[model samples]
Target: MEKAKVYYTDMHTTFRENLLQKIQRLMKSAGIETIDFDKKYVAIKIHFGEPGNLAYLRPNYAKAVADVIKSLGGRPFLTDCNTLYVGRRKNALDHIDAAYENGYSPFSTGCHVIIADGLKGTDEAYVPVPDGEYVKEAKIGRAIMDADIVISLNHFKGHEATGFGGAIKNLGMGCGSRAGKMEMHNAGKPYVKESKCIGCGSCIRNCAHSAITITDKKASINTDKCLGCGRCVGVCPVDAIKTLNDESNDILNCKMAEYTAAVIRNRPNFHISLVIDVSPYCDCHAENDTPIVPDVGMFASFDPVALDRACADAVNNQPVTPGSRLDISEHIHGDHFCDSHPETNWKTQLSHAEKLGLGTQEYELIKI
Candidate 1:
């Protein structure tokens, strides 16, 4: 495979130019304008940091991307799918509120925020994967799938499960509907916490597979019958039902790549990643620790695999921040992400993505 081009710019700001302007400049240099945007509906996928976690990207950066899309004659909307976990972003209403609370309002990003999956996280589109080994069809958020073009504006950082969350993480795991996430993270089954079940029967009512049965006013999920569509998890008012996060991190990474392929395949796509706030954990966390490394610059590319590889290389080259998790963790492996997460092997995602013909890990870093 040919080496992909990954554009980069340092985190240097002059009195005449700010980071936001630099982002716009980088995107232009990366050729985001090359896509036909006339009357196109563009999905700018981004994470609206879990409420209380300040590690996510600022709204201004999104505006920079959205503004560019509009300038190219496209209709852009900031979008993200609901979380599979119990959090402020688990459903559309709460997800939008969290986004607003985190400053992704229309007034801030110059575009409206849309929870890709509908109110209950049940609205989805099953798109077939070309050469899928783990996933046959990826359940993607309806709103994202409806878009004519896809743009990922990612906050690149460390992840416990996957060595790092980069462009693929944003588009892959981030784009999956609740059920799709279950398929990626588990073998399609969930257990009910009887103590937490209030006999509300929300799960029973939502279970299309008749996998859930209410006994003694408590819910019991039959693993044999359960399809793991994850609808029960979405409707359970008390959050008593939860999917087992039992997939190996390597499998999780590969599934994430496959899900991402289901999203961007046959669609015009672009990517941007800001490697700031280099947190040692996902932004899905409610609280953020000090950055593991000094803030690296921003990156943009048409090839997500190369973009992630470039960003990871940049972070690994930086000195660990004092008093941060990377500073405290025993640095056995030279790779900072591996040092931070000893059990995880992030290379699996990139290699699998490359195998799927998503993009090559080999890249030419073009500085703007």
Candidate 2:
């Protein structure tokens, strides 16, 4: 495979050009204008930070990207799917509220915000993954699947499960509908939380597979019949249905890669990752700890895998921040992400993505 081109620009800004302008310049220099954006629905996938977590990307960056798309005559919208976990972003209504709360309103980003999944996170499109070993079909949010073009605007950071969240993480796990997320994070089926179940019958009624039943004023899942579609989890009024999250970290990485392939396959896609505020955990958390390293820079590429590899390399090359998580931890592995989250190997995502022919990990970084 040939080395992909990953364009980069440092955080340093001149008096005349601010970060926003720099981002626009970076995108244009990286050939963003080459795409036929004229009159197309472009989904700019991003993580609207969990209300209290301050590590997610700002709306300014999104606006820059949106403005670029608009310049090319495209219709752009900021988007993200509802999260599987209990949080402000669990459902479409709540997810939009969270995005607004985190300063991602249309008024701020120069574009509207759309929760890719419909209300309750059940609206999805089953996309087939031809090269998938773990997932045959990826259940992606309907709104995301409906878009004509896809652009992943990611905040590069460490993850407890995936080692680091980058373009692949943003597109794969981030684009998954509730069921798709369940499939990626769990090796087994979901179970009813007896204590939380109020015998509401919502789960039983929503179960298309007849996998759930109510007994003794409690709900129980028949794992044999359960398909792990996660519909029960979405419909439970009381949040009683829950996934086991039993998938091993490595398998989780591989599943995420397959999900990513399902998203970008046969679609016009681009990727950009900002390696700032390098939090040690995912933005899904309500709180974020100190950054492990100094801000690296911004990166853009047509190749998601190569973009991720470049960003990971940049973060790994930087010096650790004093008093950050990495500074205090025992650095057994030389890699910063590995040292931060010892249980995870971030390379698995890139390697699996490469095997799926998403893109190569080898990249040539072009500094602007």
Best by TM-score: 2
True-structure RMSD for candidate 1: 1.0
- Candidate 1 lDDT over 1-368, as tens digits, reads 88999999999999998999999999999998899999999999999999999999999999999999999999999999998888999999999999999999999999999999899889999999969899988999999999999999999999999999999999999999988888899975788888899998888888888888888998898888877788887787788988888999999999999999999999899999999999999999999999999998999999999999999999999999999989999767999999999999999999999999999999999998
- Residue pairs clashing, model 2: none
lDDT of 1 at 308: 98
lDDT of 2 at 85: 85
TM-score of each: 0.98, 0.99
lDDT of 2: 0.93
Q: By TM-score, how accurate is candidate 1?
A: 0.98
Q: What is the C-alpha lDDT of each candidate?
A: 0.93, 0.93
For every candidate in turn, the CA RMSD to the true structure comes to 1.0, 0.8
